[model samples]
Structure formats: C-alpha cells, structure tokens
Target: MEQANQNQDYQAGDIVYVFYRNPHTQDVANIQAAAVVNHPEKENELALFLYETYYPLSDEVAIYSTEEEANQAYHYYYGEATEGVLE
Candidate 1:
C-alpha cells in the first residue's frame, strides 16, 4: 500500500472518489475512482487522474482536503453519498 507523503496527507497509491461535472450542462454526471499519482509542485496539492472513462466529456474537477468534504459535496451536487481525498 502507498503511504501518505509528508507534503500532503495522501499516499501515492491511495484511492479517492472524484465527482465529475459537465462543463456545459454544469451537472454532475457520476462519481469516479482516482488514485493519488503524486503531489504537484504547488503546496498542498494532490494530482489525480480519472480511473474510468465514461461520458468522455470534459469535467470540472474539485479537489477537497478530506474525504468527508468530498462526500458532502458529492451529496450536495448529485444527491449521492461518495468520497475523495485531498491535501
């Protein structure tokens, strides 16, 4: 298992849920699974890429500092319970 780096609280291989939103429609299409690739040069940042390919559309990505925050946002937008991770 990957361990969280000192710069951020997330490991390199840790899995996080991503709430993908449509750019034009401004609607949340679905939740996705993403892995923590690495921390970017910026402070307290986790670089995440999508784990699945669906809808194949551009989306607005929101990175939260905690899973709870992500879950809350997911529910708020999509009315569903989901989660993610951030730095």
Candidate 2:
C-alpha cells in the first residue's frame, strides 16, 4: 500500500534523481538522473529509466525529487559506503 502511494508521486514522464554505483566498479558511485516510466513488461508497474535500463521503482532504491536532494544524500551515503575504498 505504501509503495503504491509512493509510486504515484511520479508520472510516466517525470524525472527523478537517484544514487547509482558503477556495476563494474563498486568503488565508483554518484547520483544519476532517471525517468519514471511504466514498466515495459509489467502491467501497472512503475520503473526507472536509467543508463538504458529499467529498474523497478521501489523503496530499495534511493530516489530524490531533485538534484540537490540527490547530492545531499550522495554525500551522506557515499561516505559510509566507501569507507573501505581507499582513494
């Protein structure tokens, strides 16, 4: 119920910002802009369009309504996430 309500905040054409880590290099991470779109294969489900891929829109993802928010969140989370990754 809560997830459904959250999904409603963005329409199919809405743009959102999210924290993304390089799949190939866990040490590299940053915020990325994504698009909210209906899932290509799922009915009535929302998906995030990023890097030419579709990811399910859910709480597991750190999504922000604006770039500022995403940047703030990235600073906070990145510090903790990369604590072991030496520069």
Number of the top-ranking candidate, with TM-score as the measure:
2
TM-score of each: 0.43, 0.78
lDDT of 1 by residue, 7-84 (tens): 445656676666655566664355556676644454544567574432211134454444665666666765643322
Deviating ranges (above 4 Å) for candidate 1: 1-8, 23-25, 39-46, 51-72, 80-87
C-alpha root-mean-square deviation, each candidate = 9.5, 5.8
Write one digit per residue (lDDT tens) for candidate 2, span 1-87: 011124447789989887688899987877778999999999998899999999999988878787766666666655656422323
Q: Find the candidate with the highest lDDT and give its number.
A: 2
Report the poorest 10 consecutive residues by lDDT, candidate 2: 1-10
Task: Count residue pairs with overlapping backbones in model 1.
Answer: 0
lDDT of each structure? 0.51, 0.74
**Residue 11 CA displacement from its true place in model 1, Å:** 1.5
